[model samples]
Target: MSPIKNPTTFFAYIRRAPFGGRLTQGQIDGVNAILDAWEYFKLTDHRWLANILAQVFHETGGRILPVRETFASTDKAAIANLEKAWKAGKLSSVKTPYWREGWFGRGQIQITHKANYLKLGQRLGVDLVKNPAKTLDPVIGARIAIVGMAEGLFTGKKLGDFFSHNTDDPVGARAIVNGSNKAKLIATYHKAFLDAIEAARGAVDAADALPEAAIADDVKPAESSTVMSLLGGTVGTAGMSALLGVNNPWGFGIAALVLLLGAGAGYMFLSGRWSVNRIKGHA
Candidate 1:
């Protein structure tokens, strides 16, 4: 059996190498809640989880972008205009002279480009072009990213199905994400996705076994008591009496004497004669 079948081992994998970076307690809780929701939504595959993590890590250096004050003012209208520029090809000039062009693609997963943000925001019930900072929230970012991954850029094809369909097409969506070395990146992402699935399966199996395990634990004491009673009945009725005679008669006698003395004192107290004499003398 794979160690991943064990919940403890599976959680150890998560604790050692969680997707996001330097998560606070609250962030970790949020991440766990997201994972639970994903499981509830039947998205429990480790590969998908890891892919999301890698995408976010690659985009935002694993740090959540400040909501209102990272690249510019958190103005919804301004963000919408930026998207309009990207779709119009007016903002194609890499004026910043860095890796990518503009600064609007700022978040955990970097929801870049204006059109994508508008689409994702609409699906996630947020005004992405306006409150771009909402994408920095891990839960919102993960949900939007998942939606985008499942549903392509304004296309109806699921991203996974699309990649599989265009595995041989050099200019496909996969190629756009990974560039010239798209095959290698796709393979890596695919592996991460598979790992996430296996981990999630293990977690489910472990959860299913929990009730049975609890029942077994509860039954153990009863079994132990039965065995003890049998042993005691046999021993007390047979060889134990003989062994007690030989083991230390004097010590047993001393214990009996101590017990008798304790009983005699208790009897005297119960009789209440001393207490009665004191009470009568005081009166």
Candidate 2:
């Protein structure tokens, strides 16, 4: 079981870590969805959660949330080049029509193409084909990111391949999604998130160990039912913003921009824009 089970603590840790700056209500719901998915998938390691959160935080532009698919460029030539790049990479063969119009790269992991969506939809028992945009649904997106990465459904690199009790290679874990495109940057974010998560876990554990009488009536711990209820109910969920589309096939180029949030988060941490001290203030 993860020590950071309480959604409040889990999200607070995220907000404190690097680029995670006050996640929006929808993003909070996304984090909750990930928590539910984590249990459903039976992922046991805290390290895996930390690494996953780091990747997601980067993938969602440091909001520590889920977002609609983004585009790289709207220029005609750039779109043409993007199509060629996808073909060369053998990622898709549908050509320009379906590539340009079909729903592709809709999830947080940027699950691409009609075939892939149908396949994932079958696995999860969700009707992604009829409602392809549901892939961007926070709950569904959480499941995709967690299940896909853990099972190596993406790039043939599973989370277990890089993270375990004996070995921890966050940079190498980038292969679980893309093949080390910004492995070092994601790794840096992973470290900050890991530390923050551990701290939150420790706080929860310590609170649990305390006697009921020791805690003041008004001073509720983050894991307390009161805290959880307050967190879940106070900030109501909202629809995520619409997808920022490009003129070309929604593939790696624009997807790469979203993924670059990993490096952006690192920059936030280094620049002191988001820090442990600041997080405490919010807490």
- Local accuracy by lDDT, each model: 0.44, 0.62
Clashes of each: 11, 1
- lDDT of candidate 1 over 1-283, digit per residue (tens): 2223443223323333433212233333334434543554466434445554444333443332323213445555446656666667876764442212333554444555667678888877788777666776766765765666555543443446533533422124343234333445444544543454465455343432221121112223223222223233433444333333422323433433354455567667888844445445654
Instruction: Report the number of the highest-lDDT candidate.
Output: 2
lDDT of 2 by residue, 14-82 (tens): 554564443345555555667778888877887788788778877877644445445442334434655
- Name the lDDT of candidate 1: 0.44
Indicate the residue-level lDDT of 162 in model 1. Answer: 34
Reference-based TM-score of each model: 0.44, 0.62
Clashing pairs in 2: 72-254
**Model 1: residue 78 alpha-carbon error in angstroms:** 15
Candidate 1: where are CA atoms >4 Å away?
1-7, 14-47, 62-103, 154-158, 162-193, 196-200, 203-283
